[model samples]
Structure formats: structure tokens, C-alpha cells
Target chain A: MAPLLEARSLCKAFGAVTAADNISVAVAEREVVGIIGANGAGKTTFVNMVTGYLKPDTGSISYQGRDITRLGPRATARTGICRSFQIPQTFARFTVLDNMLVALNVARKRDLFFWRPAHDAELDAVAQGLLAGLGISGHRDQIAGTLPQGVRKILDIAMAMVSAPKVILLDEPTSGISTDEKHAAMDTVMNALGERGVTILFVEHDMEIVERYAGRVIAFYDGRILADGAPAQVLSDADVRRYVVGGELHRRQPRKGVA
Target chain B: MSVLTDRNVLVLLAAIPLLIAAGPIMPDWVRFFLQVSLASGLAVLGVVVQMRAGLVSFGQGLYYCLGAYAAGMTGHFVGVTDVFALLGLGIVVAAGVAVVLGFLMSRYREIFFAMLSLALSMILYGLLVKAEVLGSTDGFNLPKATFLGLAPTEQALRFAVYALTCAVTLLAAIFLYRYLKSPMGRIGEAIAQNEIRVEYLGSSARTVVHITYVLAAALSGAGGALAALANGHVDPEMANWTTSGQFVFVALLSGTGNVAAPLIGNFLLEMIRVYAVAWSPYTWQLILGATMLLVILFLPGGLWSLVERRKAGG
Candidate 1:
């Protein structure tokens, strides 16, 4: 089958630092792929380039057999490639339900300028249902900014799911979440995306999350892919063990049973 | 049917008779003050819309003055005395200008947007002062405004203009209310919060801002035409940065609490300024400045927060 997304020989440099260096990867349909790397390992750089947030100095990106290398974030999103930020991006002052409703409008491709009242019985019902599914309906009327950090991240994921995109890119889905709460958060995100059969390429720092959720794992080291395979194989790769996963894996592995 | 059922439309309907009745009984100066207040309130309404999207157009007076000049010039030269024609032309001219300027303005945000807007309004101010036929700095009177085909006597004309001002402002309010409640309006709030996220949600911040700019300009234009009719004059000072700043001031005074807030805020501001100038002519600005300071310190959401707080409490 044709890859859902493909990037070839992606290279990017920011002044003195190399962010993505001759990197290439492809994601299959409905594949739950976890990408791991140390800071500045070019995981985000690659994601940015693919999402049209940053232009890669060299290479091409294609989605579903069409070239999308130069499409901007808005156009890329319209093409069924959606993303959520590392830090939850939300309309902080708007009600949680309002956030979902706006996303729904975009997803449905409704004429945004339609002059009727924004909320009708049917749309509100759908929005409420979506929020309930994300376990955030109780806070429907609350401003998103005031929501707890973990809930905010979940809300961001909820917004991303509104479009039911062909592929979703999540940057650090559990970054600011507490260690105790990360598993629950990831569980909610994974289950929601899984139910929709979304192809996901998420950048994660947690090895356990990468192992437990990812069907395939791609490990990055200093702007290059060090290993790409099943989680156990890549996590145990000699170079990955030496440079990336080493002692941190040993310390966190014992706690893996919680998920 | 939906337009008729809208709450804003209902409010406008209810207000028309009350305003018309009040016009006849109110003292002449009081009637004049109300007319100017309602007209200026419409301009502030434009500011309020841009504010909701997290944009501050310090050059809104550019459109306001353009609307006035458009109306005045057309009435003076074309012999178009029909107030409706002039008002419609003003909106078209202003919106046309906005379509061009919004391309540049929408590309900016925060202080850059504010400064660029201010610069544009000032450029209009400079040009208007230099244009001799348009009355230059001294400005010119608008030919007597006529409604439909009948030119009412002076006292009757005051009431007509006052009634017209109320009706047009209310209509603008109703449309603006719908715009504020539309999906695009919600996206405006989202753009204010996070532009990147708005893009990821499949909307362009620039596109939303552009539409909003044009809408705001059209509104300011309408307000300017109404004001020109009410005051019987159009001056270069109408586009001056100070006039634009006052619109911003009214926006701050109104808050983004709701669409009606700016309109009410404009009325209260005009009332206060009138009283201040009468009671303490030389130091009236000092009083106005102090009141603004107090509102910023004590009621950051502007005067509308009082109503919002009451609703929340209830």
C-alpha cells in the first residue's frame, strides 16, 4: 500500500545547529508511530517541516500520493493532516465547548460566515457528546485557560480529533503532565485516536509510552534516525541503548506496569 | 424570519419608537448630544469588533473620516441629498478602502497593527488638510440632509436625523451581533488566543482579520456619515489620530463584554464630557482622564463588567 505520508532526505539547519540532517521516513495508514529523541534531536524540526510550519532546506514531503512540501499549516490541515502542540494551544478565554464547536465547524467545512446563531440544538448536542467522550463535558462552560494542565492537554487532543484527520501529529502529548497523570492522559488520547483509526506520529520522551502505545518506534539521535523498528528491537539497539535510552530506560522500565 | 426573530433586531424595533418620542421632548442641546453620541457610538462599535479579535486599529478614524468625506463630497457635488444614498455610498467607499488597506493591516498583529493603523489614519488627515477643494483644514458643511424626498424644517430635521441615527445604529448593532455570534466570530476570539492553533484548526488568522477589518471599516464609515449629517460638517480633524484615539478610548470604556457595551459606553462618555466641559471648561480633559484611569484600575473590563458581574452572580 502507498504510504500515508512520506518525507525524503529532509535537511534543515538553524544558524549553527543542524536540526534535521538527511532524514527520511514514511508512515502507513492507521499506524501508531512513536518518535523519541533527546532535545534538539530534530524530531520537532521534522514535524515542523512536514506540517509546513518550517520549510526544510532540502527534500520533499508527500501525503496520500500528492506533493505537499510547500502547503502552509492551514492548507495542510485542510488536507486532513492535523496537529496538536507540545503545550496545549487553545482559545484560553473561550468556553471549552466553544473551542470544540469551532473545530467542528472547520471539520465539517461549513461556511464560517453563516449568519445564524453559532449554536443550535443539533450542533451543541454533537459538541457536548464529543466533550463527554473526552471526559471534559463537566467543564464545558468553563474557560479553557482555567482548566488544569492535564485536562488542557486532553482538550487540545480533543480539538484535534474534531476533524478526524487522515493523520495527526502530536508534539509531546504528555510533556507538562505530571508523572502520575501522564499514563491516564496518554490513555485518553490513544483510545480516542484509536477509535477513529487515525494515523498518528507522536513525538514522545517517555519510553514506556513509546513502548506501550506505539506499534512501531523510530528513535532519533543528534539529528539522525538511530533505529527504526518494533519498540523492543529499537529500544534494545546497541547504539540506542548507549546514547539515547541507556540508564533512563532501566530507571523507568520497572514502572511500566502502571500503564 | 431568522433576522426578525433575532434578539438584537427585536431590541432595535423596540428602541425606535422610544427614541422618536424622546426626541421631541428632550431639550435641543440634549437632542443634539444624543444624536452625536449615537453616531460616535457606532464608530466605537467598530473598534469593539476589532478588539474582540485581539486587534486594535488606532487608525479607525481613517475610515470614519473617509465615510464622512465620501458622504459630504457626494452630497455637495453630485447633488445627492438623500441621506440613505450618502450613507450607503459612505459604507461602500470605506469598505472599498478597507479591502485594500486590510490586505496590509491584516498581515500584522499587536502593536505593529495598532501603529500601522495610526499611520494610515494620519496619512488621510495630512491629505485632507492639503486638498483645497474639499475645504482643507477649515472643512465644509454637508448640504442639508433629506430623508427619502422630504426636507423637514430645521427643528423637524433635528428629530429626523436623531430618529435616523438611532435606527441605523440599531441596525448596525443587530448585524454586528450576528457577526459576533457567527462561527467566524468565534474564530476571531481563537485568533486572539492562538494564531497557530487557529491555522491547525483549518482557518487563516489573516483571513478572519481581513474580514473583520472590512466590516469594522464599513461600520466606521456608516457612523461617520451619520455624524456628518448630525453635525452638518466634515473636517480633516475627523481623521486625525486624536479622533481615532477617542474611538479606541470608547472601546476600552466599553470592553468586549458585549456588542451593546460600546454603544452605551459612548453615550455615557459623551454625557460625561458634556457635563465636564460645562462645569469645568478648561480642565474637562483632566476629569475625563481621571475617570479613564479609575475605570482601568477598578474595572479592567470597562463599564460592561458591572452588568456581566450581575449576570454571573444571578
Candidate 2:
């Protein structure tokens, strides 16, 4: 079967600086593809281009066999492509469940008429289930901004998951999360997506996360793909070693007893 | 409980009749106060829309004037004194203007948006002041409005008009509260927080903001038309930048939380103006300025947020 999402030679630039340079990748259905890069390796830019937040100067993005490169974010989302921001950018003044309800409305393509109570029992149930899956059912009524960082991260993923998209892009899902919560959060995200058969394309700086969760890894350096293969192969590659993986591999080697 | 409920809105809707019935029992000045409060309250609702979406539009007066002028002109030349028809024309004119101006206004941000709005309203003010047919600077006086077909004279008619204003303001307020509670409402809040993030989430911030601008303009237009009907006059000063500033003042005093905030703010301001001017008309502006400064400094989120805090604590 054709890949669920295909990016062909995508390139983006800002003034003289190139953000994404001649990059191409594909994500298969039900696959977890990890993008590993340094601070400004254009990981987020690549995701933005795919999700239609930013248009590429060159390249076509096809989702489910249709070209969606030029579609705006809402159009792309309507086509079952959604993204979660690096930080949990939620409706701070609203309740957690209300946030999910908004996502559910978008996913179901319902006109937003709050006076007319939502009649989609299935959507409500699904949102509750996702919240429960993320272990945030206890705080369903809490204001999203007041939640702990770990819970907020989970809520962000949960909101994205509400759309039931074919592919979901997570930008640095565990960036500010505490070390103790990172693994659990990642596990919940991956497991929930896996259970729903949703494809995931996530960017991460942590090589251990890439190794543990990613079925495939793409390493980016200086706005270009440095390596693309299994995590072990990409991590062991000499060029990746010199560029993206040098410090990360060295730090993890001792902990994994592989020095 | 959700304030967006139809039943809740209907219950509020029922209060309009009660207020209308009680209007005859109140003194003439009290009835006049209610009419002014309703007019200002509607304009403040327009302010709430802009402020809630992180926009500050100083051109609301442009639409307000558009409504007033549309109603005045239609009544003068078209001979349509039917209140509903005049209101419809006012809203249509305002929405049309908003569509044209919003295309340009939606592209600008922050202070530029506010400045552009002010410029647009000032341009309208200049035109109205220059046009002798539009009553030049003195403004046009509207004849008695015939409600549906009933023509009552002077005091009885003014009371009837005040009742109509109350009904329209309450309906508009309830509709706005419902609009903000919908899916678009959530998207609006997201846009206010982070436009880029909203776009990344597969939503168009521009489209959302533009729609909001047009809706706000339409509301302001309705308010302006009603004010003209209630006061029986239309003037260039209605479109002045000072009028826009007044709406902003009301919005800031109310915050954007509840539908009742603007009504409360308008009432308080009008009441203060009445009493302050009674004591010394020359010091009224100074008193208003000082009171606004205190409100901004002490309650930045406006009075609605204060009410919310109180409710949460209690």
C-alpha cells in the first residue's frame, strides 16, 4: 500500500536562511516515525510544511494519495491531518473537557452553536475515553492552564487525538516535561495513537526516546536529512555520529551499559 | 450551568416585556436613563467582540454612524419609519462596510488595526460634517417613529421606543453570548492566545477574525440606529473618535466575560455622568477620566472578571 503521507523534496527558506532544504520523507499507516535533530534543524518546519501551517517553495505533500501541499491548516485538518504544538497551547480559560469538545467539533465538522448542546454522544464518549487513557479524567473539569506540565502535555496530545486523524504530528512532545514523567507521557501518546491505528510523526532531541518509540528514525542536520533508517543504523552512522548523534549517543552509551 | 442555553436566553428575553410594562411607573428621567443605557450597552457589546479576540478597533464609531445615518436617511427620504425595516437597513449597511474595510483591516495587527479603524471613522466624521444634506455639524432630527403601524405621540412614543431598545439590546447580548460559546468561539479564544498555533491546528485565524469584525460592526450599527431612533437625532459626532473611545471605555470597565458586563458598565457610567454633571458639568470629563483610570489600574480584567473571582471564592 502507498504511504499514508508523502513529502517530495520539500524546501522552505526565510530571507537568506534555509529552514528546510530539499527534504523528502513518507510515513506509512500505523507507523511511528521519529525525527531527530539539533535546536534549529528545521524539524518543526518540516512538520509545519506537512500540516499546511507554512507553504514550501518547492515540493508536494500528499496525504492519503491526494496532493495537500497548498491547503491551509484548517483544510489539511479537515482532510485528517492534525498537529500538536511543542508547548501545550490550549484555551487557558476553558475547562479541559471544553478544549476536547472544541477539537471534537472540528473533527466532526459541526457548526459551533454552544446554545444547542452537542448531540454527538459518540464524540463525547471518545473524548472522555482519550482523557481517561491519558490519566487526566480526574482533571477533566480543571482549567487547562492550571494543570501540571506533565498533565498539560498529555492534554495537548489528547486534544490532538480527538480529531481521529490519519496522521498526527507532535512537535517536541516531551520538551519541558520532567525526567520522571517523560517516559510515561511518551508511552501514553504512542500507545493511544497505536490503539487508534493513527500514524505519528514526532520530533525529539532525546535519542533514547527515538530508540525506544520510533520504528524508523530520520536525523536532520543544518536543514538537511543527515541519516534515515532504523534507529540503530542511524545512530551508528559515522556522519550522524559526527553531526547529530555525537553527544546524545555518548550520554546514553554509559546508561545502557554499551560503552 | 451554561449561560448559552436557549431557556436562559428566553428567560432573559421575558424580562424585556416586564421592563416595558414597568416603564410607565418610572419617572421620565429614569426612562431616559434606561434608553441611553440600552444604546450604550449595544455599542459596548461590539467592543466586547473586538477585545475578546485580542483586537482593539477604534473604528466602531464608523459603523455606529453608518447605522445612525442609514436609519436617518431611510426615514427622511425613503419614508420607512417602521422600526424593524430601519434596523435591518442599518445592519446591512454596517455589514457591507465592514466587509470592505475588514478585508484591509484584518491584515493589520495591534496598534495599526486600532489606528486604521480610527482613521476610517474620522474620515466618515469629516464627510458627515461636510455634507449639508446630512445636517452638517448640527445633525438631522428624526420624526416620531411608527412602531409596526402604531403612532403614539411624544411621551408615550418615547416610552414605547425605549421598550423597543431594551428588547433589541437584550436579544443582541444573548445572541453574542451564544456565539462565543460555540466551536468558532473556542477557535476565537485560541486565535487570541496564539494565532500561529491556531493556524497550525488547521484553522484560519484571518477568516475567524474577519467574521468577528463584521459581526461586531453589525452590532454597532444596530446600536447606532436604535440610538438615533430613541434620541430622534443623527449627528456626525456619533461617528467621532470620542464615541469609539467611549465604547472602549465601556468594554474595559466590563471585561469580556459575561453578557451583563457591558450593560452594567453602561449603567454605571451614565449614572455617574448624570450625577457628576448635575453637581458640576465642567468637571464631568475629569471625573470620568479619573474613574476610568482607577478602574483600569485596579481591575485590568474589568468588572466581569471581578464578579467571576467573587463567585469562584464564594
Candidate 3:
């Protein structure tokens, strides 16, 4: 079968700076992938291009065997590709459960135009079930703005998941989370997502998370993929180590032959 | 207790009968004040509807004026004084304009949207001021409105108009509440909160704004028609910037807390205007400005927040 989502020779630029250059990626069904990169390395640009938040300067993207490169974010989401943000985006004034309900309510376009309340009991049940699965049901009544960082992160992912998209791009799933809660948050998210058999691509700076949860890892440097393989292999690749994982030039081991 | 909640549908529905029952004992001025208030409230309600989607227009008077003229023209040219027909024509005309303008309006946000709306209303004002046949700036008197074929006499006319206004206002409030509770309506608030998130949820923010624009225009149209009928006259002033500003002021004062808020806010505002103008006359606007300032500073949520605070506190 064709890959769940495929981007071909994608290139995007802002003024003289290249956000994504000659980038191509394929996400297969049911695969859990982790992307590692430094700031401004084009990880988010890749996700943005795929989810149709930003159009690629040159390239084609296909989903489920149909061309989706020209689609907008709303159209792409309807085609089963959704994305969550680095900073959680939610309706701050609404209750946490209401946030989920918004996702659920907007997902069903046919039943949306009626005089009946948007807070239908059926959708309410589904929202509650989703919240419970993410271990955030206890905060359902709390205003989303006041939610703890970990809970808000889960809520963000949960919103992207509510549509049951076949592929989800999560930008820094554990970015704002406390160090102690990182694994727990990942465990809860991965386990909940696993039950639904979702294919997830998450960006993270934490090496341990990439090694532990990712079935495949792709390392990005500048605007290109530096390494793509199993976590152990890619994380140890000399170029990935030097350009991505290794923070500074002083931290790198000089090449023996060249020296 | 949830004053901002749509659950107040029943309370809104109940208010109709309660007001109708009280109409008999009311003085002529009170009845006149209420009908005018109810009509203006509908126009302000239009403003609030758009506010839900994080959109505001300084040109809402464009539709209000259009509604009145559309209805006014029907009587002037078509000789149709049946109230329902006039109101229906008003809605159709306003909605038609909104449909075309909404496409353009939907593309804009914040200040651009406000200025564009103001510009459109002023265009109408200028046209109305110049058109000689439509009575120019002086405007023209409307024929007495009749229900179906039955025309109420002078003695019963006040109550008749008052009752009609109540029924029409109630229906508008209820339908608007339902829209607010609907998914599309909720989408407006979501769009207000985060337009990007709304798009990722698989709905168009532009479409929501367009629908809301049309919906608001229709309500303002109905209000203008009813007001024209009640006042027995229509004027270019209906589309003035000050008039549109008044609608915005009433919308902010009412808060988006409940469907009933606009009507209550308009009524209270009319009462305040009556007292202020009676006492201060030339400085009445200063008094209204101070009132609005106080509302902004202390009751930022509008008058409805008082109800919300009491419920939250209790």
C-alpha cells in the first residue's frame, strides 16, 4: 500500500532564508516517528507544509493517494491530516471539556447547522471519554486558560486526535511540560494514541524521549534531514551528532583522518 | 445563575408574556419607550452577534437604514402598509446587501473591518440625503401599519403596536439564541478565540463570519422596519454613523452574556437617555459617555456581569 502521507521534493523559503529545502518525507500508517532538531532547523516548517498551514514553494504532497498540496489547513484536516501547536492553542475562556467539545462539534459539519445545542449529550459523552483517556477528565470543568502546562499539552494533542485523523503532526509535545512530568505525559499520550492505532509524528529536543517512544527517528539540520533511521542508529550518526544533537563545536570530536 | 449561558432560553421566552401583561398598566410614554427600545435592541443585538465572532462593524447603521428604507420604499412606491410585508421586504433587502458585502466584509478583521463598515453606511447616508423622491433628508411618513387586513384604531393602536413588537422581539431573540447554541454559532466564539485552531478543526472562519454578517443584517432589518412602523416615519438618520455607534454602544453595554441582554440594555439605556436629556439636555451625550466609561472600567463584562458575579459568588 502507498504510504499514508507523502511529500515530494518540498522547498519553501522566506526572503533569502530557506525554511525547507529539497525536503521529502513519507509517513506510513500506524508508525510512531520522532523528529529531532535544533531551533530554526525546519521541523515545524515541514509539519506546516504537510498540514497545509503553509504552502510549499516547490513540491507535491499526497494523502491517501490524492493530491493535497494546494489544500488549505481546513481542507487538509478534512482529509485526515491534523496538527497540534508548539504552544497549546485552545479556547481559553471556555471550560476544558468545552475545548474538546469544540473540536468534536466542528468535526461534524452536517449536524452543525441546527437549532439544537452544540453541547449535545452524545458529543458530551465522547468529549468526556476523550478527556478521561488522556487522564485529564478531572480538569474538565476548569477553564482551559488556567490548566496546568502538562494538562494543556494533553488537551492540545487530544484536540488534534478528536477528528480521528489517520496522521497527526505534534509540534513539541512535551515542550512546556516540567521535566518530571515529561515521561508521564508521553506515556499517557502514546498509550492513549496507541489504542486508536494512530500514526503520530512528534518533534522533540529530548533525546531520551526520541529513543524511548519513537519507532523511527529523523534528525534535521538547518533545512534538510541529516539522518533517518532507527533511533539508535540515527542518534549516533556522526553528522547528526555534530549538526543536531551536539550543541557546540567544542563538544564535537575532531575527525582523526582530517586532523 | 449562568447568566452568560444560552440556557436562559426559557427566561427569554417567559419575558415576552410578562411584558405583554404589563403593557396595559403602562403609561403611553412607557409603551412608546419600550417599542422603540425593543426595535433598537434588535439592531444592537445584530452588533452583538458579530462580536461573538471577534468581528465589529461601525457601519451596522447601513443595514438599519437599509431596512427602514426598504420597508419605507415599499410603502412609498408599492403602497403596501401591511406590517408583515414591510418587515419581510426589509429583511430581504438587508440580507441581499449583506450577502454581497459579507463576502468582502468576511475577508477583513479588526480596524479594517470597522472602517469599511463605517464607509458603507456613510455611502448610504449620502445617497439618501441626495435622493429627492425618497424625501431627501426630511424623509417621509409611513402609512399606519395593519395586521393582516385588520387595522387597529387610535385608542387600541398603541397596545396593538406594543403587542406586535413584543411578539416579533421574542421570536428574534429566541432564534438568535438557538443560533448562538448551534455549532456554527459556537464556531464564532472559537474563531474569536483562535482562527487558526478553527481552521484545523475543519471549518472556514470566513464562512462563519459571512453567515453572522447576514444574520445580523436580517435582524437589524426587522428592527428598522418595526421602528419605522412604530414611529410612523423613516429618515436618513437611521443610517447615520452616530446611530451605528449607538448600536455598538448598546451591544457593549448589554454584554454577550445572554439573548435577553440587548433588550434589557437598550431599555435601560433609553431610560437613562430620557433622564439625562431631561436633566442635562445639551450635555446628555457627556452623561452617556460617562456611563459607558463607568461600564467599561467597573463592569467590563457589561451589565450582565453583575448577574454572573452574583451567581459565581453565591
Candidate 4:
């Protein structure tokens, strides 16, 4: 089967730092993929290039057989590829529901000059339902900027889902979240986005979350893919173990039972 | 239809009759002050409109000047005295200029946008002062406007212009109030809040800003035409940076809290200026500057925040 999304020989550089170097990765339909990497391993850079936030210096990115290499952020989003930022982007002063309503209004293609009210009963209902689906409806009227990090992350994901995207990239969906709260936040994000045939690629540092959630894992090391296979296989690869998952896996290995 | 029931909309609608009735009893200077306030209030309304999208057009008077010139020159050169024709032409001319300039203007933000706008209006000011046919810096007089071919007596003519000013301003306020509630308007506010999010949501921030600039220019055009009719003249100073700066001042004083806020803020400024000049003619500008500073320090939302606070029960 043709890959749902494919990146071919992608390379991006910012002066002396090589963010993505000769990297290529393909994601299959309905597959939940976790991307593991150390700090500055180019995981987020990969997401940025794929989402058209930054144009790769070399090679092409295709989604569902259509070239989107030069498509900028807004056009790329319209093509059913959407992403949530590592830092949640929202209208800080608006209430949570208002932010969602704005998202819904903007989801209407080329209606920038429509005379109709942007938030009618229909749009409001959709926003409310989406918020409820993400289990953050209680924060509907609270100002978005004042919300906790976990709730904001869920709100960001909720806004991304409004477009009914075919492929969604979440950059550290659980980052900055308390360890105790990250699971619940990820659960909300994953459950809300668990629709059939939607490809999910999430950049994550947590090995346990990746093992539990992703069907496949792609480990990144210093701007290159170190290992790519089933979660168990790649997580145990020698180079991936040495470069990306070494200290992280040490915490879970059978420390006392080895004797 | 629901827009008509909004409190701001109601305030706008209510002002029409109250002002027309009050015009006959006020002194001539008082009536003139109200007319200038409402006319220039419309110019300030354009500034407030752009402000919603978090854009500050320091050259808003470009449209104001164009609108006035459209009216003034229409009467001065083409001999069209009908007020409606003048106002409509004003809108068309201003909108036309905006459609052209908005391409370059929407590509900028923050200080760059503000400075570019200021530069464009100054360019117009420079050209107008040098053009001998347009009376150079001294400018030229506007022929009195007739209402649908019916010529009123002198007193009635003054009152007609004042009444017309009230009605036109209210209409602009009503349209803007509705716009501020619409999705296009919301997108503008969203663009101001977060341009990246706006783009990611599948809308163009540039398109929204362009449309906003055109709409705001059309509004200023209408205001300029009215000011020309009221003052019986048009001058290069109308496009000068100081005049544009005053529109910005009125917008700030009003706080962009609502469409009606501009009218209230402009009238208050007019009354304060009159009083300051009367009490100490030489120091009136000093008083004006000090008043603005005080408002900035105490009421960051401008004069309208007091009303908002009262409504919010704070």
C-alpha cells in the first residue's frame, strides 16, 4: 500500500546546526507512530518541515500522493495535515470556548468576508461538542491564558481536530505536563483523535507512553534516524539504546530481580 | 436583525433623533462643535476598526483627506452639490486607494505598519500643499451641498448638514457594530491575537487585514466628505500627520471598547478642547496633551473603560 505520508531525503540547516540531515520517513494509514529523540535530535524540525512551517532545503514531502513540499502552513493545513505546537497557540485573552469557536469559524474555507455572524448556534454547538469530547468542557468559559498547561495542551489538540485532519502531528503532546497528569492529558488527546484511519505521529521523550500507545517507533539521533521498527524492536536497538533511550530504559530494567 | 437589538447598536440608533432635536436649541458654535465632533468621530471610527485587528494606521487621514477631496473637488470642479453623491464618491475613492495600498500595508505589522501608513499620508500632504490647482496649503472652499435638489434656507442648511452628520455617523456605527460581531470581524480580532493560529486554522491573515483596511478607508472617506460639507472647505491639513494623529488620539481616548465609544470620545475631546481654549487659549494644546497622558496612565482602555468597568461591576 502507498504510504499515507512520505518525506524523502529531507535536509534543513540553520547555520552550523544541522536540524534534519538526509532524513526520510514514511507513515502508514491508521498507524500511531511515536518519534523518539534526544534534545536537538531534529524531531520537531521534522514535524516543522512536514507541516510546511519551514521549507526543507532538499527533497520532497508527499501526502496521499500529492506533493506539498512548498505549501506554506495555511495551505498545508487545508490539505488535511494539521499539527499542534509544543507550546500551545491560542487567543490568550479569549475564553476557551471562544478560542474553539474562532477555530471552527476559520475552518470554513475562504469565508473571510462572509457577512454572517462567525459564531452562530451551529458553530457554537460544534465547538462545545469538541470541547466536551476532549473532556475540557468545564473550562469553556475560563480564559485560555489562565488555564493549566495540561488543559491548554488538550485545547490545542482540540483546535487541531476541528479541521477533521487526515494526518496529525503532535509535538510533545505531554511535555511540560506533570508526570501524574501527562497520562490523563495524553488519554484525552489520543481518545479524541482515535477516529478510524487517521494517521498519528507524536514526538515524545517518554518511552513508556510510546510503548503503550504507538504501534511503531522511529528513534532519531543527531539529525538522523537511528532505528525504525516495532516499538519493542527499535526501543532495544543497540545504537538507539546507546544514543537515545539509554538512561531512560535503565529506570525500568529489572534492577533487583537480575539475581 | 439581532444586531439591531445590541446595546451599542441601540445607542447608535438613539443618537440620531436626540441630536437632530437638540440641534435647534443649541447655540451656533455648540451646533458646529457637535457637527465637527460627529464628522471627525467617523474618521476616528476607522482607526478603531483597524485597531480591532491590532493594527494602528498612523496615516488614516489619507482616506479622510481623499474622501474630503472627493467631495470638495466634486463640487469644486464637477459642480455636483448633492451630499449623497459626494459621500458615495468619497467611499469609492477611499476604498479604491485602500485596495491598492492594502496590498503593501497588510504585508506589515506593529510599528512598520504604523510608520508606513504615516508616511503615505505625509506623501499626500506634501503633494496637496504643492498642487496650485487645489489651492496649495491654503486649500479651497466647498460649494454648499443640496439635499435631493431641495435647497434649504441658511439656518436650515446649517441644521441639515448637522442633521446629516448625525445620521451618517449613526449608520457607520451600526454597520461597524454588526461587522465587529461577524466571523470576518472575529477573524480580524483573532489575527491580532495570534496570526499563526489564524493561518493554521485555514484563513489568511493578509486577506483579513486587507479587507479591514479597505473597509476602514471607506469609513474614513465618508467621514471626510461630511467634514468637508460641514466646514465648507477642504485643506491639505486634513491629510497632515497631525490630523491623522488626532484620529489615533480619539481612537485611544475611546479605547476601542465598542463602535459607539469613538463618538463619545471624540465629542468629549471636542468639549474639553473648547473649554481649555476658553480658559487658557495659549495653553490649550498643553492641556490636551496632558489629558491624553493622564488617560493613558489611569485608563489603559481609554475613556470607554470607565463604562465597561461600571457594566462589569468593578
TM-score for each of the candidates: 0.96, 0.93, 0.95, 0.97
lDDT of each: 0.88, 0.84, 0.88, 0.90
List model 3 lDDT by residue over A111-208, tens digit each. Answer: 24847678877898999999999899999999999999889989999999999988888899999899899999999999988888889999998887
Which is the leading candidate under DockQ?
A: 4
Cα shift from native, residue A50, model 2 (Å)? 1.3
Q: Model 3: per-residue lDDT, tens digit, B179-242?
A: 8877888888888899999999898899889999999999999889888888889999999999
lDDT of candidate 2 over B157-274, digit per residue (tens)? 7877788888888888888877776677667776777677566556667877888899899999999999888888999998899999988888888787887789878888888888
lDDT of 3 at A107: 78
lDDT value, residue B240 of candidate 1: 97
10 residues in a row with least lDDT, candidate 4 chain B: B1-10
| Candidate 1 lDDT, A1-259, residue by residue in tens | 9999999998899998988888899999999999998888889988899888999889899999999999999899899998888889998988898888888877777536748666777888988887888787899999999999888988998898888798999999998899998998788778878888899999998888889999999988888899999999999999998888787788865575676
Error of 1 at A110 (Å): 3.2
Chain A TM-score for each of the predictions: 0.94, 0.94, 0.93, 0.96
- The candidate scoring highest on lDDT is 4
Cα error of candidate 1 at position B146, Å: 2.4
Give stretches of model 4 more than 4 Å off.
Answer: A257-259
Question: Model 2, stretches more than 4 Å misplaced?
Answer: A111-124, A255-259, B1-11
Model 2 chain A poorest 10 in a row by lDDT: A111-120
DockQ scores for all predicted structures: 0.63, 0.46, 0.58, 0.68
Summarize candidate 4's per-residue lDDT along A31-142 as a digit string, tens digits.
8999999999999999999998999999899999999999999999999999998999988888998888888877876247446677678788889999998889999999
